[model samples]
Target: MNLTKAIAGRRSTRDYTTEAVDEKLIFRLIDAAVQAPSAMNQQPWTFTVIRDQALLERISQEAKACMLATTPVGAHSSHFQTLLSDEDFQLFYHAPVLILISGNEPNQWIVEDCALAAENLMLAAYAEGLGTCWIGFAQGYLNTPQGKHALGLPAEWTPVAPIIVGHPKSAPAPIAHKAPSIHWIG
Candidate 1:
């Protein structure tokens, strides 16, 4: 598929089918994610794939509780609140597959590298007729002790992003993209 089409088609899917995503497909998505650019060629990243139903449920519950605790009263940030519904709070659309991305501490550009990886994965999933939502709200929960145990994250790996993937239960409509703000030298 062309890059334009993929870009136009990609959306943050919040509803997903219960159908299981193939392991091979998940790996393929990761393969695509690694293709993203990193600073100084330093690829400091790790991924934790969660497929166990019980574990996913636990993570979801823990995450929701964390959100409730962290969300300041009356503060509604779309990235942290609007996307987290009762049904989608922790598991995030219950997509049956969740990809947890972490980065090494020493790399100053870990955040950028991890974000690029996430975009690559989301777009790749869309191209493959799958749906994905980049989940950043989970950071609050994942930063805690329970979250760390749930994902089996190493002490050295900091959570950068988590993504939920599955077949779309509802197709996302195209959203308007803002015009680029740039100053070009002739």
Candidate 2:
């Protein structure tokens, strides 16, 4: 597919089919991800591909449990409590493959690099007739003891985002765009 078509087709998909995504496709997406721009070409990013069903279920359950452990009296706790009921957040829309993007350093530039990599992978999946959702909740999950061991990430690695990739159960409708506010340019 052409770049324009791929860009136009990409969307944040939270619904996925049970069909297993091929490992080769995941590798291809990661290859595209690494090609993304990095800060001074430091390439501090790491990709963790998770495919085990038992591990995925464990992570989902543990994430909910950890989020529920927050003090109920806290202002933010109620929000977390409500999140546990959401199915998408619970199982990550049941995507077959969960790609965790981690950065070696917590430098601000590393976040930018990881974000670019995520975009590249998402577009790559879209072109391959797949769907993707960039999940931020995985970061919180990684902070918990269970999630840390589940992904087997090193102490130095910081989980940035979880990219859920799989066959699309339903394609999201086109989102309307608003014109950006801009300053004058020469």
Candidate 3:
């Protein structure tokens, strides 16, 4: 697929089939991710590919519990609370793989850098006839000490993006986009 088409077609996939994403595809996406631009060319990024569905389930359960314990009463929106409180809710949406983007070292632009890499990964997946979603629900938990231990991440690294990739059960319908708003001075 062309770059413009990939950019326009990519969507945050929430539903996926049971089929597992291939290792080669995961690596290909990671390679594409690293090709993204980094601040000062400092590519301080690491990709953690998680293929075990059971582990993902455990992480989802634990993360949900942690969030429930920490969230202030009434702080979350009703829908969010319902989602988190529901034991049936799977944080990764049952996607067969999670490609976590992390910082290899501390830097002012680490988050931004990793985020750029994440976009590349997502677009690459879209181009590869795969589905991907930036699982925001997994980030906080993945960054915690327990979460880090579970993922076997190095002590110094920081998790920035928890992206799930898999085959979609069905293609998501195109969502309508609002016109861009810009303020210009020149």
lDDT string, candidate 2, 6-35, tens digits: 998899998888999998888999999999
What is the Å distance of residue 31 in model 3 from its true position? 0.7
The sequence of per-residue lDDT tens digits that candidate 1 reaches over residues 10-53 is 99998888999999999999999999998888888888898787
Error of 2 at 183 (Å): 2.2
Cα misplacement distance, residue 48 of candidate 3 (Å): 0.6
Give the alpha-carbon lDDT of every model: 0.83, 0.83, 0.92
Q: Pick the candidate with the highest TM-score.
A: 3
TM-score: model 1 vs. ground truth: 0.87
Tell me the tens digit of each residue's lDDT in model 3 across 61-135: 998988777666675666677899998999999999999999989899999999999999999999999999998
Query: At residue 185, what lDDT does model 2 achieve?
Result: 85
Please report the TM-score between candidate 3 and the true structure. 0.95
Positional deviation of residue 74's Cα in model 1 after best superposition, in angstroms: 5.1
Could you tell me the lDDT of residue 102 within candidate 1? 85
The deviation in Å at residue 54 for candidate 2 is: 2.0
